[model samples]
Target: MKKRKLVMGTFGGLLLLFGAVTGFQTLTLESRQPAAKPTSVEIDKDKALQHLSEAITYQTISYEDRTKFDFSEFDRFIEFLQNSYPSIHEELALERINNYALLYKWEGTDSSLNPIGLTSHYDVVPVLKGTEENWEQEPFSGTVTEDAIWGRGTLDDKIGVIGIMEAVEYLIQEGYQPKRDMYFMFGFDEEIGGEEGAKAIAETLKNRGIRFDFVMDEGGAIVENMVPGVSQPVGVVGVSEKGSATVELTIEGSGGHSSQPKDQTNIGRIAKAISKLEETQFHAELRGPGEDLFEFVAPEMNLGMKYVFANKAIFKPVIEHILLQEPASAALIRTTIAPTIFQAGEQSNVLPEKATAIINLRLMPGDSLEEVKSFIEKTIDDKQISVSISGSEATKVSSVDGWEFSTIQQAARNVYGNAVIAPYLMVAGSDAKHYDDVSNNTYRFLPVQITAEDLNRMHGTNEHVSIDNYLNSIKFYAELIKEANK
Candidate 1:
C-alpha cells in the first residue's frame, strides 16, 4: 500500500513539474509587436490601377508545349511595358535574354554594396478550355469592376511585375535613388518550369560573375485566419521552397488471358506497391522552416496552443501528430507523396503484361531524391518493381536572422500594420528557386492580403484582385525599395 502511494505521489509531482515548466516557457515567450509604420508614399492610384488592368489584356500565356506559345502576344506585352512605364525604360539599362525574359538594372551610387534583385514572371497560366465561361468576366478581358480588377494574372503574378514597375516609376519621379543597385527580372515561362526563362537568366548572371545580396520573388501572401491561434492576419514569407520529384514505378511480368491469370499479376504487384507506399508514408517531424513558422506564431497563440508550442521540447511528438491530421498542415512538416498518374490494363477483359504508376513527391528541405528512391524500394520491398526518380533537391535555407529578412518583415509591417509577418516553408515551387545560386538569400513573398478563395483563383477560373489589395501591393513594393536601401 505504501509503495503504490509513493508511485502515485511521484507521478503527480512529475506532472506538476511539467505544468510549471510549460507555464514558465509561455510567460517567457517573446512578443511579436508590429513595427512602426513608415511614412506613406503617394502613388497615382488611377494610373497604377489602369496599368495592371491593361497589362492583363495582352494574353502573355505560357504553355507546356513551346510550339503553342503565341510569340506575338509576348512582343505586344513588352511593347506595352515600354510605352506605359517610359521613365523605367529610359532610366534603367534593360537586357533581353533569348528574346523574351527581361532584366532591368537601376544603377546605384554605391558599388561596394551587393545588388538586390526583384523577380516575377509575367507569363500567366492558360485558362482551361471548358472553364472559360465560368469566369464572371472574360478571362482575357482585364475587366475593371467596381471593387476588383478581374482577369488572369491579377493574382498569380502580373501584379508583381506591374507593381514593381509602378513602384520604381513612382520612386524615380520622386527622385528617390537606391543606395544599392536594384535589378528587376521578369521571366516568360514560369508556369511550364523556368528552364527557358529564369534558369537561363541565372546562368547568364552566373557566367558574368554577378551575385546579389538577396532576391525577392512572388510567393506566400498575407492570409487571414490562416494560422489558427493568431487573431491578426499572418504574412508568411517562404524562406525555402520544397523540392519536387517524380517517381515512376513499373512492374513487368508474363501476360495471360483474363480467366487464366497468374496468382500475382503485373497490375496486382503495382497496385500493392502503391498501397504500401500510401500506408507507409514519410515520417512527419517539425523542423527547419516548419518549426520556424510555429516559433514566430506561437507567441500570438491562445494559452492552450502557446503551452504546447512553447514546450515543444516536450510536446514535439504531440504537435507533429496534430499537424499530421490535415493534408495541408501535414505537408508542412514532412515530404509528401501523391500518386499522380497510373496505367495498367489496356482493356478491361485482358490481363496486362505490364503496369506503371507515377508518384509525385514534394521533398522536405533535408530529404533528397536518392533517399526518396531508396525509401520506395525499401518500403515496397519488391525487387521485381523498378523505380526511377528525378528532380531538384530543396534549395538552401536562407538566413531568417539577417537584415535581409528583417527588411522584408519590416517592409511588410509598414504596409500591413495588423499582420504578423512570419517565415514559412513553401510547398509549391516558384521562380525564386532559380535565383538561389545568384543570390545569398532568396526570400519569396507576394505582398498582398488574400483569402482562401483568392488562393484558389491563382491558377483557376475567374482570377481577380481587389483594388485595395492591388494598391497595397504597389505600396509594399515602393516601401521594400526604400527599406532595401536603408
Candidate 2:
C-alpha cells in the first residue's frame, strides 16, 4: 500500500513538472520578438483592380480531358495580354510552349546575374453543376463591385497573373528596370495537373539547361487568424510541397453462399485490414518547413504560446498533442491519410470474391515512396491482401535562410507592413512543383490577405478578392521583382 502511494505521488509530480516546463517554454518563445520594422510601398489600387477584373473575363478554363478545352480562349487571353501591356510586350521576348503555355523573358542590364522566374496558371476550375446559382455574381462575368471583385479565377490565381503584369507595367512607367533577368510564365492547364502546360515548360527550360536563382509560384497567402498565437496576417511561403500517392488494397477469394459463412470472409478480412491501417497510421514527426513555421511565428506570439514553442525540445509531447487537436496544424506536421474509394461485393445475397480500397496519402518531405509502400504492407499484414502504390514523392525543401526566400518575405513585408511572413510546407501541388526540376530553389507564395472562408471560395462558388487585397498583391509582386534585382 505504501509503495503504491509513493508511485502515484511520483507520477503526479512528473505530470506537474511537464506542465510547468511547457508553460515556461511557451512564454520564452513568445517573448523573443524584441522589435518589428514597418515598411511601406506606394500602390495604384485602381489600375491593379482594373487589371484583375479584366483578367477574370477570359474563360481560360482547364478540363481534365484536354480535348474538351477551348484553345481559342487561351489564344484570346494571350492577345489580351499583348494588347493590355504594350510596354511589356515590346520589351520582353515571349515564347509559347505546347501552343498555350506563355513564357516571357525580360532581359536585365546585367547578363552575369542569374534570372528569377515568377509563374502562375491562368486556367481556373469549372463551376460545379449545382453551385452556379449560389454565386453572388456570375463566375465568369468579372463583376467589380464597390467592395469586391467577383469571379472564378479572381482568387485561384487570375489575381497572380494580372497582379504581376500590373506591377511590371507600373514599374516600367516609373522608369524602374530590373538588374537581373525576370521571367513570367503562365500555364494554361495547371488545374488539370499541368501536363501540357507547366510540365512542357519545365522540360523545355531543362533541355536548354536554364536554371534559376529561384522561382516563385502560387502558394500560401496572408490569412487572418491562421496561426493560433499571432494576430497579424500570416503570409506563408511554401518551402516544400507534400507528395501525393495512391495505395490500393485488394483481396480475392472464392464466392460462397451467405447462409453458412466462414469465421472470416474476403470482405471481412479486407475491412479488418483497412481498419488496422487507419488505426496504425504513418509515424508523425515534427520537422521540415512545417516546424519552421512555428519557429518564426513563436517569437512574435504571446507569452504563453512563446514559452511552449520556445521549449519545444523539452515539451515536445505536449506541443504535439496540442498541434494534433487542430487539423490545420496537424497537416503541417505529418502525413495525412484519406480513404477516397472503397469497392467490395456487388450483390446482396451471396458473398462476392473480391474487395478493394483506394487510399490517398500526402507524404511529408524526406519520406520515400518505397518506405510508404513497405509501411502499408507491414501494417496490413494479411498475406491474402495485396497492395500497390503509385505517385510522386515530396519535393525538395527550399532554404529559408537564402536570399531567395528573404527577398520574398522582405518584399511582402514592404508591401504589407503588418503581415507576418513565414515559411511553410504546401499540401497541394502547383506549377511550382514542375519548376523544381529547373530551379535549385523553388518558393511558392501568393501575396494576398484572405480569410479561411476565402480559401473555400478558391474553387467554390462566390470566389472573389477584396479590391484592397488585389492591389496589395500587385505591390507585393512589384516589390518582389525589385528585391530580387537587388
Candidate achieving the largest lDDT: 1
Candidate that would win on TM-score: 1
Candidate 1 per-residue lDDT, tens place, 165-258, comes to 9999999999999999999999999999998889888999999988999999999999998887789899999999999999999988888789
Q: What is the model-wide C-alpha lDDT for candidate 2?
A: 0.86
Candidate models: Cα lDDT each: 0.92, 0.86
Flag regions of model 1 displaced more than 4 Å: 1-13, 32-34
Per the 3 Å backbone cut-off, how many clashing residue pairs does candidate 2 have?
A: 9
Model 2: per-residue lDDT, tens digit, 1-486? 999999999999999998787766565444212133343556667666666777888888888887888888888888888888998988889999999899999989998888899999999999999988899899998999998999999888888899888888878887888998898999989998998888899899899878899999999998888888788788899999999999998998887888887899888888898889778877776788988888888877767677767887876788777888877788877888888898887778788788888999999998899999898889888888999999999999999877788888888887777888889999999989999889979998989888889999999989999988888888788888988998
Candidate 1 versus the native: TM-score?
A: 0.97
For model 2, what is the alpha-carbon lDDT of residue 172?
Answer: 85
Q: What is the lDDT of candidate 1?
A: 0.92
Cα lDDT, model 1, residue 272: 94
